[model samples]
Target: MRISTFLLVLILLTSCSEKDKHPYTFYYWKTKLALDQEEKKALDKATAPYLYTRFFDINKVNGRFQPVAVITENKSFDTDKQIVPTVFITNQTFLNISKEEIQFLAENIHHLIEKKIKEYHLNAGQEIQIDCDWTAGTRDDYFSFLKQLKKISHKGVSCTLRLHQVKDKALMGIPPVEKVYLMCYSTSSPLENSDKNSILDVNILKSYLSKLEDYPIKKIEVALPIYSWGIVTNHLGKHKLINALSQNDLKNPNFKKVSDHEIEILKDGFYFGNYLNKGFMIKVEEITNDQLRDVITFLDKKIPEFTIIYYQLDAKFVINQNFKLISKFQGDF
Candidate 1:
């Protein structure tokens, strides 16, 4: 009886220790590597030890695969904070791409990463992450490109996994990487005229994460959304994503409250560089603190060991977030 009781206590202690060890990091996903005073304060408040910075994106332009929106590092990061160079490749880049082209692309990507690291004096060279929403048709080529990149870069490689890829791994196949960052947001397209929040819907998240534990990749990190956007729609059913506009921006006299999550443009001319007509509707989609806590609780039950990476590092969002609530389930950041 005593032995059984001791074993039970040991199990409880082990579980608690594991729960306390949930390390978290941030993803800096901006085209320009510069942080304002507020952003710097947010970083310090979060106590993030490392940042996954986007180096550039690869897209197909005029039938040629090329890097676009390459990051310009205007400011250097703290020496103590590590930076993980990240590259986002569009899935269309792999459509009908040849093996030779894949190899060439991998080589050029590696070279550019090295060049940027050197040029910007960035304290990064350890790990590289690739973000791509690859389909079954392009899976093989994408995996091949990752393999080539891994071989050439000689650094740990990681990739982003969407919800569909997690649930349908058998069909989509997994990428050749050491770790996969499961993106827990962006469940749907913003262009859709649905009432649901495309940034994050708990119902949609639950549907896709049913078999999360059974995912083949053991080392899985989760990225949660901390950003919000305004979906502007006109009478003709046309939609545009005004990323800079948030719920707070709706308080202006130019907008009239339509609903708790929606507003109508009143006598609008130009707002946030977008010309809007009167009567245009805007849907504000954002994740709340309570919703974030619920997601953390749910994920803690599913993933025994994983890191939480906030989708991005933005001052407006990060400064307003309650990190105490965010770190409640997973311990302090």
Candidate 2:
């Protein structure tokens, strides 16, 4: 009897462990649908069930809503992994859009996604994700649009939830979707001149997620930041984001270290195709492996079940870390 009981308990524990394991995924935010050798290797290592590919972005252009940066090349497609076509619509698109316009926009978006899937011969999944940072003013219209989209597309719809949206759901209102992908990065504005890393800050994340456990949305997925950028501040207090810049790139004779994260350009004509003047400040913000682990630990406590989708699959960033380490965070915590 004692041996039987022990075996039963062990079986239950194994079942629970399998249930709690989180699935991993990746987001392809590039305009083209082509993958290099490094990116292909990362995707294979991740073994994600699905890949969220950005189809295009929508914005109001001269009183007309149109799609921009549509995927023009399709050099790669994985038959094993399903593709979730993601559309990014600007919040301003719904600012003053009428009900009739919202309906029309939904139909147009559905048609475009369908056309793309057919044209590219993609192994598209039955779900589509909408990425928008809607405010209170546009909340009602955006929700209505989502409903219209669901009706027209006849597929599972998901949207990206910002940190502020989770904290202020009462004011902003919950989106009309079955699931929401909570974006855990971009805690602060990049244009702001500050010493803190704008990409991912644990304290800032905690402040925004004070009420995460109580958040009504139960089926919540997570997307973490795996990318970084440089905030270039000019002499006149102007700020701009310089992409493809890293801390190692700043370690040069032309630059002087101001702090651990800040650097001053000593003599620069043009670096990385961006002209920099002497005394200009560059703040490098990148997420470390330790920070990623901390974020996973903090989130695991509040949310029981979730799929971790890295913000993007970039060769430049993915090659810097061990594929096994980056893909297996779920089992570690």
Candidate 3:
């Protein structure tokens, strides 16, 4: 009787301890910061401790790289949640920046970010995340900018990691940051003719993660995709991306269901600001709950403990997810 009682106590303690750990974080990548009803419900359900907000983007304006901050209502949100500002930079923008302009770029960028944080009153969170899909040509400039940015924000710094960067570490040298958030989605190109999912392919994910064990980075987290998109291919076989379009949007009589994903456009006109040809095909790509579960299980074996940030908190995706299961995958259960 005593042995059984002791075992039960141990189990209870373990469960309580797990619950006490920080809840998983989330990323709000939308240009507008307002949260819809569904998004608010999802955020409440997840009970996330950190919210990584995309403050602005760095794009090339004329011949100069400038910071374009996204407009956020900044009116309603949970004040208890910590905010981690994220800055996105176009890879081409770094290529345009001259060697002598690196310091100027870094200083101006940091000032712009600081202004946004002050305006939003997001002073509680100390960590700042940099989101850039850097390439071999821009790696030197990107890394140098990171080193400079670190001097401005003395707090924790984190950058995103793509699968290709993980595979080719020689060409994609590590960024000088405190933390690296491995983006585990977008493993394949949606423009390709393949039937496999572009968002999350288990086999492709395994291939990249197999090399993760050898990755030199120590502090690492993961960002998963919870959203979906449609790839519109014209008669010329050129692909154009359409965001947040659903099956209901394709229910028009002009569209014929070719396959589960592919849709044949019988009539061509202006649709979503694009000139749709008659032979246009729209392929819908998404990650289902079961697929997400499988990914969590796979990662459970490889990385038992780490932070998880959903791609973005969209209403459609958040309204349909099982928050309990997602919390479990984040090691909160």
Among these predicted structures, which one has the highest TM-score? 2
- lDDT string for model 3 (1-333, tens) is 999999999999988766434246578887776787888777766656778888889888788877786647548754456778889988888876786688887787778778877777775477778889999999999998888788766767789999999889988898888789989899899888788988899789888887676778877787888878889987677888888766667787888999877788899787767788888899888777677667676766665556778877888777777755664644321
Give the clash count for each candidate: 0, 0, 0
lDDT of 1 by residue, 1-333 (tens): 999999999999987676555567678989988887767776665544778899999999888988999988776555456788999999999999998999999999999999999998888857999999999999999999999999999999899999999889999998888799989899899999798889999889988998898887888887888888889899899998877557788887888898988988899699778899999999988888777777777777777677778877888778767664475565321
lDDT of 1 at 137: 96
- lDDT-wise, the better of 1 and 3 is 1
Off by over 4 Å in 3: 15-22, 77-79, 96-100, 269-275, 329-333
Q: Using Cα atoms with residue i matched to residue i, what is each candidate's TM-score against the true structure?
A: 0.91, 0.93, 0.89
Worst 10 residues of 3 by lDDT: 324-333
For each candidate, the alpha-carbon lDDT, in order, equals 0.84, 0.86, 0.78
Which candidate leads the pack in lDDT? 2
Q: Which segments of candidate 1 are over 4 A away from where they belong?
A: 1-19, 76-79, 330-333
How well is each residue in 111-180 modelled by candidate 2, as lDDT tens digits? 9999999988888989999999999999999999999999999998999999999989899999989899
Candidate 1 minimal-lDDT segment of 10 residues = 324-333
